[model samples]
Target: MTSFGIWGLIPPVLTITLAFITKDVMVSLFLGIFSGALIVAGGNPLVAIINLTDMVAGSLNDGWNIRIFLFCALLGGLVGMLSKTGSAHAFGRWAADKLHTQKTSLLMTWFCGLLIFIDDYFNSLAVGTVMRPITDKNKVSRAQLAYILDSTAAPVCILVPISSWVITVMSIVKGSEGFDALGVSEFSFFIRSVPYNLYALLTIIMVLVIILSGRNFGPMAKSIAYAQETGNLYNEKYGPAPGEIDIDGDVNADKAKPLDMLFPIIVLIVSAVILFPVTTYLSSIDGETITSVGAAAASMSLGDAFNNTDASMALFYAVIFTLVITYIYYTVRKLFTIKEASGAITDGIKSMVPALIILTMAWTIGTVIKNSPADGGLGLAAYLSDAVVGGGFPIALVPVIAFALSALISFSTGTSWGTFAIMIPIVMPIAVGLAQAKGLADAGLLNAAMISVSAVLGGSVFGDHASPISDTTILSSTGAGCPHLEHVATQMPYAITTAVCALVGFFVGGIFLNVLAAWIVTLACFAAAMVFLPKILNN
Candidate 1:
């Protein structure tokens, strides 16, 4: 209701408008940031300039933000090197030989998506890049590719125990007095409750079912028909012709050994998994039991052991490692000259310039929201939680309301982390208090589990799956090479369907039924979507 809250809506509106108007997302994003800075400075031109520099500096200094930026940069470099070495094409050819049918291709796409569950950003980019060519060869549309990536992004993250997300949610739950009142450790409660996260579990099943059934609906169905008629799943400009080799014919002719493409990705995945635990251990090397953020902080500080510890410094190291490894592997194999490898890296970075701009602008807008007057921003989330409790709603409905509010904030702000940060402290205590009030003393364990895990997961992913400003959404669009708005428009119906079903499942299945029955009902809904919807829509 405050002017600051109204101001918050301006950045996305301007960014989206400029992106469509100029067909340049980056330009639009920067302008949006500038406008936000102006508003934050209260129209003081001099203060606006100063705040802009400070915002950028603060973002760069933020430990989590720095690591994420570096991760994206390293991923970009790895993708470039793979493309330069023709490894992607090599893998595509190999996959083509092994899988003969559309169903196989689709299933493979889903499996790969499932396996790369470490991070949503990583999953969206890696899966889309690796699978796009194969899907196109099998006549699948870019919209379909976007759908798979979008569905997997949030759903996969929710299920993973050791992900950055799990850590964030755990911290929030543990800090809340409400959770302590429920008489269980937040982490223990969350682990036990994972089985009951019906929405996330069902969404994963729904994705696999969609892949197996080969039935598309909404914009996705139209896209599939278009691809069938035209034989171009993505835009004609982006992909190779049906029978022709890629632009680099000689490179395509040379069959890359499987290790060339698979080895690095496997290394990246295994390294992350192994290093996470090791990093956690090392973080406590300072005599402090390392929490998740603490571990990230420790990892940032262990520059020499890991080869770079400073956030800014580690980024440079990662870049150098990627370039050197790429050069050595491709140059020795004679996949490309030194010049071609260099050019490919340059092109890859150039391709991501727009994304970087968008990220920076998004970061700035986040800054404005963080620093804005309490009355002017979404501080209303806290007030709203109080209002809900005052309205005599059952304690069980706390999680449901939190989930819905989180979804709304995520949708409007276009970031899950921000929404999570704002809601967790406010909602968790209310849940615990309500559970006690309901005289569910024995059921405290179950109630805590539901409130902490179910609510957080639901809230975190609601916007991520559907929000146009969401990083996952953008990455999915970029990966599929689908127009951003097109992907949003096509996928909205599916996201809404799942969300609606999830609401009913959470209320009736999660609250009323036993835990096992809740899961069954959730899975049943997924199955119905897979089997019934396509037939109904196609007819």
Candidate 2:
């Protein structure tokens, strides 16, 4: 109910503007955070400076956020070791023999993204680390690679049932009063809603279409053309990208083997998959003590454990375990000496410095914008939520409305999780109420509810794909070793196209309360996009 009026809009708007203009994410994020701090400090410059530092520190204080920070840095170290040991190069060589063409190489990257659906952060960084070398070898532009990474990362996570994103959505839904009143369990609702998640589904479809058809438009087309013609993965004008490191000049390059890289990554993936439920089960045990891992496994259902899993913590532990084993593995193989391995890891951590700084600033600015007014933050989500609810649209349009509003909030704030937290509770009840008021049957009402929830899920992903400040977007660029803004610029067109298709789907579904009708119209829209968009935009 409390807000800073229009003041909430300034920070994100300014940050986004400055990022595009200056192509400096750190400075843009800092000024955005400082401006918000200044507002929070009531226009006092000195207090604003102090508030900025405190806010940045405060954002880092959360256990989950800090774990994610460590996971990224540790993952970078793992990547560095992989490169230094010539693992990435050797694997790329192995892949190049089979992949042969750009299309096959990119398709493999897209498939890899789909396979790693546990967490978006893990998906982006892990897929990028392994696939970047292959993509580069095949003349795929870093922008195209980033786009594939971004599109698949969040979209696939949201679509899969056993992912961190789904668990979070389930938790939110379980806590909502509407789901309780409807006598629906969160798991059931989420599963039912998945089919209606037009945006995420359409976005994934769009990625395949682009990859298969080799159609490029907008900045992505330009970047691809430039890469194919000049043999440079990125624009020279953009210079070095965040998380970019040279893996070609390592001393041990001649001795690297394909398994050297593949083995460590396989360890990371298997470790994360195992740890997610194990940690959650361990955390669930209370009062009585569970003695062994086998005993813990016997105690709870895998579904329940995953429902309550801490994805960040799971990834944090996975990366740590991988780093330890990898260091020993590389050294034992005589690829690098102990000191050499240490130095490579240090450089790898250093490579992630830009991503880390940008991530920290992104969190700080999100805090400034989403924190309540009483907490010295702008309450942007509250303001926008209030505006949408107060607009007084017809009930049948709830799906379309929810989609648009969720996109706006997520894009402006650059945090889809924050958007979900704000929108779900508000939108769910209204949807149920509207369905009831229309004298709809139980099946029809459930259909409406599913469509509405799916819209929110889809629209939030649109922002995650397109927003410059989005953590997934940032990580995608970092992992792909592409300039952040160039990734943003190239990805926006594809994101917008998918969004347009989703909007049509939501509109049709809302009017008819039919999921099948929604899918048909959505596909039709996409078909039109595929046939005509390149012709229109490529010019």
Candidate 3:
């Protein structure tokens, strides 16, 4: 790392500010990357441009990065194929007739997101793809649909014990020595933190409040109102246009069966169920083959199995399984000519180009901050940990401050997992030290540590929901066929509302050493914000 120092913060700050002002995600991200390169290149404009290319190349070439990109792209093709076979329209018509109201449509989407708890990526793309048509027909805006897709994604994943998120968090926390002092398992500690993870809990709460109340505000309100009034679900400013998620122009709607959509989705879910364990067993293998489920479970604890699993690779496998099955099913039923299927696949991959570009740029900018000699990257994290310690903030407020720090970094980086990589290591050690020094009881110390971990997780997800360049954000837009910037505009008010409540909840939780009370107040705050803020903002 170079000696760039505090200047590393410039890129993300600049990106957010510019994106808000420009409403142009692509240029905002590129400029953010360029700014980081400029600082890292010692202000030499030419060198910075050259550094930009290298940084982008490095990010795209990364194995994990490429894996996620391919997964999104391949899944995009599946969506396109669904539309091409006229399954989306048939399904939408059928869903519209059944749901009969906008509230049910949105709630159904939210419920689906909650059910797909195995992985966040799966939750996002799958929910968006499946629900877009239904929601659109019921007069729900793409922005609103994207909001539900994103809100329920990482937030739901983090809460579920069997998810990749839980497995990862457990692995990291278990490695910390603090839990030894408390005499609790990492999984147990994480479970206790659930009530205290204000943002995640409140986000889901806010979604329900918005849906059940049948009220919305800000850009989202306008979008929903417009859709209801005009039967035009897309706002032109925030997207490439809304019909891309629709049927091919030449398709015969009558030929499309709802099963054309349901069958593949079912296959994808099954593949994920099968692959999660197989991936775990394989990754956990030292030198021997795992011949049976019983043997695999015996060899590793559930948490350990998940920790060892490669979620990205496993997702890749799921997408491939879905694509192969979907295409073959279509061709076998004579629903698609070989040429039509091939074209749909090509267009589907093409549709993901915007998201892929944003993901690459976001990844590059993250590297600029982390790897740069300046204080903005890894150095920034270290510096902040020291600053937080050195600051005279009370022990009870550590969770609040940690939440803020995690949010900033994740927002800047556009990756919650990356935020976890940086913030968890810092917070874990701090928790152990603080807990030991306070001479706190086991429950008290556990409470403090849980707050800290939960803060990081909640804040990372909130920030990811807010960030324009975020992968889930892009995918949500792609799935809903909304404009990328429009999704950001509509989503920010909701995310920030939950975040403000969560921040207050953390402080209250710390003060009273009670999680349940904090959750009640947090959800209440979200409810008030939803009812009043929209009215105030609309006025």
Candidate 4:
């Protein structure tokens, strides 16, 4: 009903601009939400404030959003437990001795992120908690550490077949006629799409380029220089004062063993993995009311198990289990009293307060912008994208456009999963129609569908990586104990460079429709960009 159309982009634009100006993300998000409410309420200031309050409260009511908030709190407590037990310190000391250089320290962090491929939330918090001390000793700026943590979080998750991202995408792709007509399973389609996901691939690879080359251009370079030269891990302008970000555990380090920390973390990870199936199985049982265990097990493979899996519940229950395990183990070891364990949980959850607030604000603005059409809010973005695709946008350019559009939406909204939800339905049907109109072979049509899917996944991840308001981005900064704005400003340059290279890859792939040819050329393009862009930017 609000016919703002393309003009509806103003709210997000204002939000981003205000963040840089005010240097306060909360105020910026509030202003952005108010701007949208103003448009919806036809410029009535009082009604706009009312609308703002309602929508923000509504964002909290959504189950997915609440789950994320609770998850972050639990993850914070876990990190605190590790810190208090001196687990992170022991590992940090061991790693620092083995790594002995900035590049190696960074690589260790990246590898840890990659290893935790099950979920992005786990990846960001876990890697940051474990690697923070090593990176700090190696003179890596918290911003650089934040960038590494973020780049690996979503990008690595998207690239793997066995991750939360894959499950989400498969659910979207399962109902798509484009993928269905191709005569392949949704999971296979997702796997096929991985190679074409240029944004994700480039992002993962670029971390190495930044590390090995040591050509840190842009704000990141300045940050690293300041840290390496002065032994200061954070800059004065964007970084918090030294003591403000500290969440170190409150216990003596003399008696702490690495196992005190490692045991609980291991339980948490394994429990999460096992419970994914257990949770899904229980749901299926409730829905089907099956008496036969064999029948229930068979039905689980309809590929709906992942969809049925309650990720939040599983995570919550798993972490709780780990805490129980930790409490017992630490008690037996006489490392800390029961009171101390409770204190660590309290301290950890407290540390995550800033991140939770930022995430909630970001989600509120996203709700205002992406509310359903029937809700009578600003739904202009989808309309704007529809116009481009429907106005005879070329078939060859579909993947490229899909990638770019998805990136823009995800960037503005600060949620990759939300971006995927919006783009998958829009782009897939177009990809199919284009292929059919061109009289493509079965293989070619399938290829086209896969390309479109890949574009959406890649673009969403890329945009989320760059967006300051993104949950993963916030988590990365929080985990690194870096000032969030500095993390955003420093990583923007690196994310943008990889995204540019990926754009070219999508464009070329769209033009030719040959996966091998496009991949070869794109890798070359990425290498060239990585080699030359730094010199160009440095100059």
Candidate 5:
């Protein structure tokens, strides 16, 4: 789409390459963004620098972006306060006794990741923070914890219909061409596609299999072996982990109760669940005089409210409310004085500084790739989408092609939502047109559409799961106290294994036009891999 043609690939490629080679994400992202800006500026270095600054500023200027930034910082504060009060350690000690083994501890971590499925952002940060102390006590590597958090975050969010991811996905589905022709609502179509989302289902199953089988492989195996033998939870060569923050308050280990930690996390989760609908309702009446939640709720169904909700705003409100309640509760418990608590909160915010910087850079670089050439971007998404749409694959390969294409775009761009926005529009028409050309009836056409859509969703998640520049991936590392690149390095093999299985399933399913056949083959591939790949790779 851009005059730059293949040049659009330079930014993300450079960023990812430098990240792997130098292991400095910040510098890599900056150079990547700078390169893209230079291309957009027609090789004017001065203009590129100015454009770069403005682009990052533009990303932060969005209300949603700012809200997410604040939410992450505030969540860090809450985690810090819990740690300062010794509540996190107390809960860890209690959980360690009950869990009794490394396997159970990791399983509990996986379970917690699944339970907090409302939002991937919240799921990663909250679950990792709450589960870290326990995982650490059990000697599970931070890379492993981060992988679970990263794996569960987007994969679980995309699979669950009642999640932050669903609203975006449903909206995309609704606007997609030929979707209305099917006479099926977006929500129903989404539900139907869930069973076809082999990557997510298989990735989730892979997590359980890895834990239950205790068969680690690839870079992950080395990390696990290192942790088990050296008693070091992370690779020390990567320097101090990203999420390690020092609290200014004295530890209250002996006096702290596990409830001190559990109650706040409960409140955080419950409040988020309740506030999502409430915030959606309120946002719909932003310009009106409606001041009451009751009035807003009376006008629409709970499902409607959730579908229309502003997830970032809802989470922002949830974390703020939790912090308030937690402060009061900690005060009542005499965990710390107001001044000490304030210092802990301040230190917690400081801990998030690195994460904030990485996210900002990631957003800016994404902007660089997404913006049109005239607007000082490489238009990478457009370029990639155009290429895939023009590829002219066989009709039966649409589902698998969509899955692989979506993964490439998402990995290159570092944003799954952006991938959905681009791919769904492009994939829908292709799949529908291909089915009609094959003289398929309504049922066959619908099957093609659903499979393609599910493939896009799953593939998008795969890229987001694996990309180092992805926000969820960075947040997972921050949350789990792992080095960012270490998480990516360790998780890629597992993500790739699941993706390969999903690809095989989509390929066979595309041929048969059968969801059951797809699922069976996917499971079969995963099972076969589980029996063989781990042993081979670990050896």
Candidate 6:
């Protein structure tokens, strides 16, 4: 392996640091990308500039990035249109009217987050924006909202069999040499292993427990109390006014009807679900199957569909369906003047500008890492695994390490998909090899699978949840109307608590349960967190 020294690592580290300090995610990421390009180009000034431009252009042209941006822009437009039409406010007001209790409001938010499990990015943005007003009306803090959104996105996606993320992971795994040796079909293995993902199961349980008990701790507790006292959970800038429904002052207060909000949300969900089957069927034609990520990417690249007459054509059709349905609703309901609707879409795209810039930089960083001498990220993991596995540190710690390493890479590059792509192949083979060496080939395969998958999910989510350059985190803050760092600060303690408990669970299970150990540890951690968290808050 080649060494790029500390110089190779400096750009990503500086990006994250600056994001934390300046709270300007786009600026931080752009600087990170520029620095990486500078490193790659070295002393050639012209080459450095060209490298930067090419890095960004390549990223933008990537099918994955293009799809992500398209979805984001369209979703942003949908969200903005919903808000402007009074649909979001109307739905929020109606839901608030019906769910009189705080617990109900929280539960609804939790359920909504879970329901939007088709895609994490969509879940984070759409769920947070739609539910923010309702949560705020009921006095839930932005920290809590961010926590719910972040917690649910990756966890729920990992658990869901047909989600875009699972498809991507399975594709990566199937393509690996390890899977061929093991004779395990990617889809079947993914389905069989879902139950063993302790982090996903435990995190969901933990989120529900926090919601039901109203148990806030650390920064979350402070945030909740502050919201209750001031009636402004979204921000300190909004002032300490009580929940006042000023008919004239409320944006979109008068025009919104219950169905106006309900219809589009319902349509969005239905469209996504319906498109899944359509995309799958289309992908199966000519033996060219579209995985979840591929479907999304193909759907965004409609222009290609017109020429090639390929499976990606289904995606183009779905895009058309989305536009037509959205347009019909807007026009039939007289939601906005044609001009207003146009402006709303423009504003929606404007809101995504910052996200688009961050994404471009994130892609550039990922490319630089891939092309660098430290191409494979396995050195650190291999060293740690070798040092710890024989030292009797406990098997549970394996997943914990996986999670931590995954988190580190994801945070550095600000892309969970890239982290997953890099880590799965490197880690799984080592895990299987280690288990086989212990004369536990059968048990080794299962254990390795659990640990590798858990690590990937946990690490991917950790970075996505906390990193300011993370698109999901940024979108959550934007949706909740919270200052980005404020959301990060307020939610960090809760994430930490869950992480610590998860580590403990991994250990207990590893030493005792073997394959079932993940579940055993996860349940134990969930129970302990539920019991102890409230008391800690009281203290």
Model 3 lDDT per residue over 1-539, tens place: 44355665577667657755665556777897798788767789998898788877877786666766787688768766765776655655666677967789998888878876655655676567668767766778888898999888888988976454565565446534345666675545776778878889788888988898867888888888787787878777654753454334477767777777678768877787678667777665555576666677788876666545666667688889888988889989777899888888898778767656755665665566545264323344344434445654466777888899888767776767655644565576566556556677778878878888888998888867788877778877777788888888888988888899998888777676678867777777776786689779887
Report the C-alpha lDDT of model 1 over 1-539, residue by residue, as the tens digit: 33364455565467546654664445665676677677766788788778777877776686656654555555555656665565655665667788766778877777777766645766777677677777777777787788888888877777764344554455445544355555554445666668766657666776776777666687678767878888867544333322322323235436566467665556555454445434434444654454555565655543333332222233334444545665687678778777776676676566555444445454554444434354223222233334555666676565566667766766765666545544565565556555554566657645544644475567568787888888899888877777777788778878877776676566654365256655566567766776777778777
Comparing candidate 4 with candidate 5, which one achieves the higher lDDT? Answer: 5
Model 2 error, position 383 (Å): 4.1
- What C-alpha lDDT, on a 0 to 100 scale, does residue 269 get in candidate 2? 75
Query: Which ranges of candidate 1 are over 4 A from the true structure?
Result: 1-90, 180-190, 232-257, 260-392, 441-443, 449-453, 530-532
Residue 82 accuracy (lDDT) in model 4: 61
- Superposed on all Cα atoms, the candidates' RMSDs to the truth, in angstroms, are 8.1, 6.9, 7.1, 6.6, 6.9, 7.9
As for candidate 4, its clashing pairs are none
* Candidate 5 wrongly placed segments (more than 4 Å): 1-7, 96-204, 207-250, 286-292, 393-499, 506-518, 530-539
For residues 17-99, could you state the per-residue lDDT of candidate 2 as single tens digits?
A: 77556645567668878988998889999999998889889868977668767776777677667667766556656766788
Give the per-residue lDDT digits (tens) of candidate 5, residues 1-539.
45477997788677657755664567777898899898888899999999999998987897766776787688768766766787755655677678857889899889878876655765687678767888887789999999999999999989865454665576556645556666565655776789899999888889998999887789999999999999999997866798553222466666777787678778888898898788878776755666577778888899877666766777789989999999999999888889989988887778767656766675676567656777677767566555655675576798999899888767866667656755675577667766766678778888988998899998999988888888899999998999988899999999999999999999998998889999999989988888898779977
- Each model's lDDT comes to 0.61, 0.77, 0.72, 0.73, 0.79, 0.61
**Model 2 steric clash pairs:** none
Q: In model 2, what lDDT does residue 408 have?
A: 79
Report lDDT (Cα) of residue 395, candidate 6.
45
What TM-score would candidate 2 get against the native? 0.66
**Model 4: per-residue Cα lDDT over 1-539, one tens digit each:** 53467656777667657755664556766787788888888889999999888887876787655765676677667656665666555555666678878889999988777766655765777678778878877778998889999999999978865444655566556534345567665645776677888888888888877888887888888888789788888887885732323334566666765555467757777887777667667656654567554567677683566545666566667767876777778778776778988888788788777656656665565555555436746764455445545676677798888888888767876767655655675577678777766788688888888887788888889877889878899989888879888899889988988887777878888888877766787788777876787678767
The deviation in Å at residue 196 for candidate 1 is: 3.5
Better of 1 and 4 by TM-score: 4
lDDT of 4 at 153: 92
Better of 1 and 4 by lDDT: 4
Write down the TM-score for model 4.
0.66
